[model samples]
Target chain A: MKKNASLTRLFWTSFSISALTFGGGYVIVSLLRKQFVDKHGWMTDDEMLDILAISQSCPGVIAVNATFMAGYRLRGAAGAAAAVIGCIIPPFGIIFGLSFFYTAVKDSPAVRGVFRGLLAGVAAVIADVVVTMTTPVIKAKKVLPIVIMFAAFVANFVFNWNPAFIILFTAALGIALQLARFFRRKMAQGTGDR
Target chain B: MKYLELFWAFFKVGLMSFGGGYAAMPLVQTQIVEELGWINMTDFTDMLAISQMTPGPISINLSTFVGARMGNLLGATAAMLGCIVPSCVIMLILTRLYRKFRTLETVQCVLAVLKPATLSMIAASGGSLFLLSVFGGEPRDLWLAGFDWRAGFDWFAAVIFAVGLVLLRIKRVKVPPVLIMLGAGVLGLVFSVLPAVNG
Candidate 1:
């Protein structure tokens, strides 16, 4: 029972993190790192990173995955459920209201202008996020991902290639690389055993 | 044929989305445009542009727009429902289980890969968005190119972008999205009211 209470607190903490973060997942991550990994001593940085990767590959919202992984890490499947719900309820409630009146808001001049202004700010935020995220890849000496990033940028921006194709292709490449590396290690281990 | 399949497809999308709503673009484009064939490439592109120009998360906007396009009001409703349901349900479940495994190392490894991938995907989507915003129509002639760039980079947008960035950097103020959006709308109203700008 004591364990369950603590788990609930962590879930709510994550939920609050998601609910309050202005810029979405990446910002949420920084916040989670501070609150969960640093302040609370809940999870290590590496564990957070791993869950983030899995969440990306998986077929759901990143926030939900983070919540699930954080929860599961703490208390198994049931904890996972609690964190997921906590993260989602706020956004769902907000979006539901927005959806109903979105058309009406669209016609308002004031609303339209604000969005235009927000677009530029959003662009800047995205630029900041890109820089922050790429730091790790730069440090890791992995040129392939960087090259892929540049190629993707040019393909979508200059060549007008379909983004869907680029994503699918790169994901396949990542998976293939992982699998090949696994086989090579296995083969080396087999030789060593022999 | 099956509503459940439709629900699951979107639910999967909603659950894995990270970085932001834009991160879901490639997945959505793949699922709906390529695999499902529910929307054509052209329409999907069009919807993307519309979603960008409008306020709100691109994914939700696209879901609503596409849902309406695909199956009318109900379809829009279904798609929206499909998108939100998984996150809602899952979050509820996780809220209960969060504390026990908070210190687990295994969980962190998966997040590391996902974080970068999600970032890359968002960047990729940003590229697509730039194209949609700037170059979606018939190819502009050389003479028209200058005009488009000049007109498209409106002063209102530029000013707001600059101010927002400064605020973000210096003050570290977290400007609410709603307020920024509303500010833009007010500027538009001002422009509309001004004869010179309106023309």
Candidate 2:
């Protein structure tokens, strides 16, 4: 009974977070951290970071992935199910409603004006996302990551390259760099032993 | 038939999506806006705004909007399922392995490389959307020729965008995004209704 109640809590918590937080991805991260770590004492900050890492690394929406993992950590399969449903329901319902009414209202001058204004805000938020994401790369001060980052941007913006290709190319590049470092370390060890 | 098409198109989007919600925008744009003709460029921008305003993942929000616009509730369900199923299966496997293999050197290296790349993709995605929202009604040839700089630009949007950047980035204002948008909407409506601007 205690476990079931906790699972119910997990579901509501996940749902509310998913429902309330806008701007997606990183917003979800901060909110989840606050709820699970600071608020509930369910997980440590490090655990939250780890889940975030895994969520970002995997394919699909980061919010959903992160929540599912968090729920899984707390209460296993049932927890995962509850969280995923919670996260999805609000967006689905909202978007479904908007879609239905969009055609009728879209052409209204007031609606158009609102959307136009909203577009500016959206652009600003996205800009913040870029700035926030850029800080880590700048802090790393690694030439390779910086180069990959610029290359990926150029490829998409200028050439209109497929995003999948950019991801694959960068992953392969990462693997190759690791292999080179590994072999170089081995060679240095062999010489030292001699 | 449209349901199947929505499912298939979104399925491809799911398979290709990486980096996170914003990163998925270009892929979704490609599939839905460019390839499938499910939505026009203007509608695409509007959808992005709507998705951002609402809660949850942008990718799923986009999928639901596009699917419903194309074929109603069933279409939304099909597209949403298609968008999520691949990730769901992959993540289920990953959640298990992530517990054990997260410490591996290969994983670390891959993640490190992906970091910058993902950032770049997101920057590009944001750039494209910003471009769209700001320069949306311009002619294709005019935009490509770069001659539309003064003539084609929407000055009202540009002002709002500039003000918004300052408010969020410089002032570090804590205004919720929804409110900012609502404020902009009212301003826009006022501008449009004002005879001075419209005339």
Candidate 3:
């Protein structure tokens, strides 16, 4: 009974966060961190960080991915569904409405001004996210990640290279590094046993 | 013929775009401009600008605009739906599977690698967009003397950006993004109505 209740709470919390947040996946991160990690003590900082990492690698929306992991952690399959629904419902509703009235609302001078202001804010949010995400990269002092970031930036900005290539290349790079590390550990262990 | 192709192409782009709409841009550009020949480079750029100025995700907005251009309202709907379906279905399935393997170390490590890559992709995309915002043909070509500092400054945007930065940095204030967007719209309206001054 206690577990079920907790799962219910997780569902509502996830739903509320997704429903209310406006700027999409990036903005949702801070909110999720606050609610799940700080406010509820549902997940630790390390756990939240781990979830974020997993969400990035997977093939779906980060928010949905994070919610799935979080929900599953708390309450299994049912919990995951609740969280996913929570994350998606708001965006779906908002998008549907926007789609309906988009043509009419788009041309209003007031609306234009708001978007202008919002764009700046969105830029600010993106900057904040970049800073947050870069911390680990700096700590790890992984030259490859930095190089990849810079190269990708240059390629996309200057040459207009496709991002799909960038993502695929980096994913492959990551997998190769992991395999190398695994083999190195195994070799070291074998030598010690001798 | 073209519209159906656009729908399928964008659907593929949408499915492959894991992070979000922005992440989908490079793929969309590659398919539409480089591969399909549906839209030229200049038009694609314009579509991007228009998407930015409008509400909704960049991917959806572009799909709608491009779809409309290709085959009217139905095409727009199809493209938009195509872009969204992949993420939606994927999310649904992942949500179901998430309960079983949420805590594995190997899973954790993979995620660690992906996080940086995702960040890098977003940052790269942002840099690209910044270039377009500043150096795109429209801004450069619109200049009266081919170089007017005041008009080129985009003072309104800059001021809002600066003010927002200060508010965000110092106060730790959490202002709703929608409010800021609305404020900019009002500012634009005011600027638009103001009489032009000849230097």
Candidate 4:
């Protein structure tokens, strides 16, 4: 009974958070920290940080991933399921409703006007993202990462390379760099033994 | 046939949804807009606007919107499934081996390069959307030598874009994104109905 009560709380909490928060990803992080860390004492600060690290590390939508992990920590598999379901309902339901009207009104001139403006706004917002995301890389002062960034821009913008192939190539390159570093450390240790 | 195509496209999107939602935007743009022709650039921008306004992951919001646009309810379900299945499966594996997973140095190495690459992808996607918004044509068309660059540009949209940029520059969350889009939409409504702006 206690467990069931907890599961239900998990569901409602996740549902409310997912329903209320916008901007996705980073937006949910602080909110989750607030609920799980500060409010409920369900998780420690360190655990929330770990969840964040793991969430960002995994290859999925960061919000879903982070919430799922956070839920699992709170309870278990059932908790994860409850939280993810809660998280998805808002997007799925809201989009499902909006899609219908969008198709209907899309051809209307009034809607077209709004859409035209929305398009420009979306572009500016994306530009803001480009600035926010790139600042960290520039701050790091790493040449290789900068070169890779430029190469990627050229590949997509100029050459129209498939993004999948670009990811694969970069991943392979990164692994090779790691391997080289590993061997160099090993050789240094070997010399130190003498 | 289209259902299968939607499934396949979003499935691939799921597989590559690394880094974050923003990184996945370009991949989704490539699959749906550039490659498959499932949606136009204008529609793509609209979808992004909707995603920004709503809650949940941008990736999921996009999948649902695209799927709903393409194939209705069943199609939306198929696309949504394709998007989440990868995350579910990957998370399952990750949860089990998480302790070992943390020790692997290679993931960080990949992320080091992947971060910049993802930034590049966002820029490319943003650039395409920007061109489509301001110039009213394919980006490829814009770059061609003989293209009518002057006539192609939409001055009304250019002004909204400037306003949006100014809104974003407010530094801190004084102006939320949804409001920014709403402000632009208001501009659109007023100007779009006007005599000169072509309703």
TM-score per candidate, chains pooled: 0.64, 0.89, 0.67, 0.94
Look at candidate 2 and give me any clashing residue pairs. Answer: A114-B185
Q: What lDDT tens digits, residue by residue, belong to model 1 across residues B21-81?
A: 6667766865887678987655565455445444334455567676665555566667766
Q: How well is each residue in A87-169 modelled by candidate 3, as lDDT tens digits?
A: 65554444444445554665565545444444454444444546656777878888766776677666655565666776677
Q: Pick the candidate with the highest DockQ.
A: 4
* Per-residue lDDT of candidate 2, residues B15-80 (tens digit): 666766777787887677767687887788788888887888888899999989888899999998
lDDT tens digits, residue span B140-171, model 3: 23333655444434555566565655555554
Better of 2 and 3 by lDDT: 2
Model 1 misplaced stretches (Cα beyond 4 Å): A1-17, A29-59, A73-75, A135-141, A179-194, B1-22, B26-121, B128-153, B162-196
Best by lDDT: 4
Query: Candidate 2: which docking quality band?
Result: medium
* Model 2: how far residue B90 lies from native, Å: 2.5
Residue-level error in angstroms, candidate 3, position A104:
4.0
What fraction of the genuine interface contacts, i.e. the true contacts, does candidate 2 reproduce?
0.73
Off by over 4 Å in 4: A1-5, A191-194, B1-4
**Model-by-model lDDT, in order?**
0.58, 0.79, 0.61, 0.83
Q: How accurately is candidate 3 docked according to DockQ?
A: 0.27
The pairs that clash in candidate 3 are A53-B111, A112-B185, A113-B184, A113-B185, A114-B181, A114-B182, A114-B185, A118-B181
